[model samples]
Target: MILTVTLNTALDITYRTAALTPHATNRVAEVTERPGGKGINVARVLAALGHESVVTGFVGGRTGDALRELLAAEGPGGKAAHAAVSDSPVTDALVPIAGTTRRTIAVVDETTGDTTQLNEPGPTVTPAEWAAFLTSYEGLAARADAVALCGSLPPGVHVGAYAELVRLARAAGRPVLLDTSGEPLRRGIAARPDLVKPNADELAQLTGSREPLRATRDARRRGGRAVVASLGAAGLLAATPDGSWRAAPPMAVRGNPTGAGDSAVAGLLSGLVERLPWPERLARAVALSAATVLAPAAGEFDREAYADLLPRVAVTEQSSQPEQESHATRQHR
Candidate 1:
């Protein structure tokens, strides 16, 4: 079973308003909500692929209850979430100490198909709360086949949280997949996770370089066994211990791009846990990410797009790491 840990979960509210303008009173054409956070999205994708996954994270107040309801043992979309080590499905009753669980508002402009996001600062995690969560983390990772420590560390939490999680997963003999941005990625790399899924910007933040391959290699050198970067429209740039490969979508459909990276992580980690080969795993990641862009919902990917793109993905292993950066920018129609 796959174990996912989300430090900061939320009731993601997405609105579709045509021609969204700042400070204007706009009527939403459509709206949807989901149990959102990097880890939760990953879990959702896993469930979609018929994988058994257990999600453990902080939940409080009514929003927390809603999240639990959505991830119920027999919840919608044919269930498969819940069923964690803890009985009664573990959504630990931890207070946020300030605001409600973060509410991310995605104002998707219907006219342009562009999405503008408004993110909350997220609930503050007290030191005591942090310590408590760590106890849960250790317990969860210890018995899991694989653990995914994902998303950003909320306020009041230490910056090195993912770093510590990497250590815990290693000690428990479980491969850890760390996915986050900025400092968390940097600190987590110090602990040397089995894999990291960083998009172009996060890769830049880690290596301070614009070159994707160079940044990826630097991240790997810093202790990541592999660095898989989501290169926007170009596709996925991955450097594993075995070798490197690039995966892209087929020249066909296009749509929303929200939560593509999270979907990619889910695809890659799920394959890794299944003991699939490196090329197949890379292809799965690419297919799933492309699917995500095709899905209209926020933090959700179109499953059909994934099916269509799977066979078309190409994965090639490089004989050696390049000394200089390769300016190859290939795109699928």
Candidate 2:
């Protein structure tokens, strides 16, 4: 089973609008809320794809309770709902916390098809609380085939938290995939995760290279055995141990782009565990991402879209880079 870790969990609220103007009041056309985070989103896609995935993370207070309730919900924003439906029915288990969880707001403009986001810092996790999380991780990692350390960390947590998680997953003999940005990605890479999925901006920030290909190359050298760089609607670039390649979607899908990267991570990890070939893996990854774009709801992907796109993804392999140190040198923030 795949295990997903989210440090800064949130009650994600999305409001659709005809248009949004800064410093002006606007009525929302539609509103939806869910238990939201990178890992949680991944688990949803995995479940929809007929895979078993466990989501573990820091959740707290009333917001946390509501988040857990939502995670267990059926219909659209289901997290563990797929498991209960497909496999043996089981309740979603989102661990409780001492501090109140945060809320993430996304304003989706209908006209431009762009989203404006505002994120809270999230609650603080004390030292004792963090230790508790380690214990939880150990238990979860023991049963995890793949563990994903995903998204931004909360306040009062060290930036090296993902690094520690990577080490734990490694010790448990499970391959780990890390997806985060800025300092967390930089620090986590030092621990050498089995795989890492970073978008163009995140890659540029870590490697200090504006050029996307150069940045991905640098990222591969640093610590990732394989680097899967998400390039939005354009496609994905994967640098694996044996070789590197690019997976392009059949078309520039027009829809919501949110949560596409998380879908790609689920696709890659699920493919790896199934022992699928690289071509198939990249194809699945691209399909999942493309499906996510088609999903209008925040953090959700359409299963039918994924199935339709899976066979259409084009995977072309490229030459692997010669052995050398990664040139990624970020001015440490």
Query: TM-score: which candidate is best?
Result: 2
The collision pairs in model 1 are: none
Residue 203, model 2, lDDT: 93
The whole-model C-alpha lDDT of candidate 1 against the native structure comes to 0.78
Cα-lDDT of candidate 2? 0.83
Indicate the TM-score of model 2.
Answer: 0.90
Q: Per-residue lDDT tens digits of candidate 1, residues 23-131?
A: 8789998776667888887887876776767786666667767666655543333353332211223223233434357778888888898889899777777787777
Candidate 2: the clashing residue pairs are none
TM-score of each: 0.88, 0.90
- Tell me the tens digit of each residue's lDDT in model 2 across 1-333: 788898888998888999998899999998877778988888877777777788888899888988887776742434543222223221254566789999999989998988999988799899898898899889989988889989998998998999999999999899999999999999999899999999989998898876666677789778988898998887988888767788999999988778889989989998989999888998999998898888767567777888899889988886544223233233332
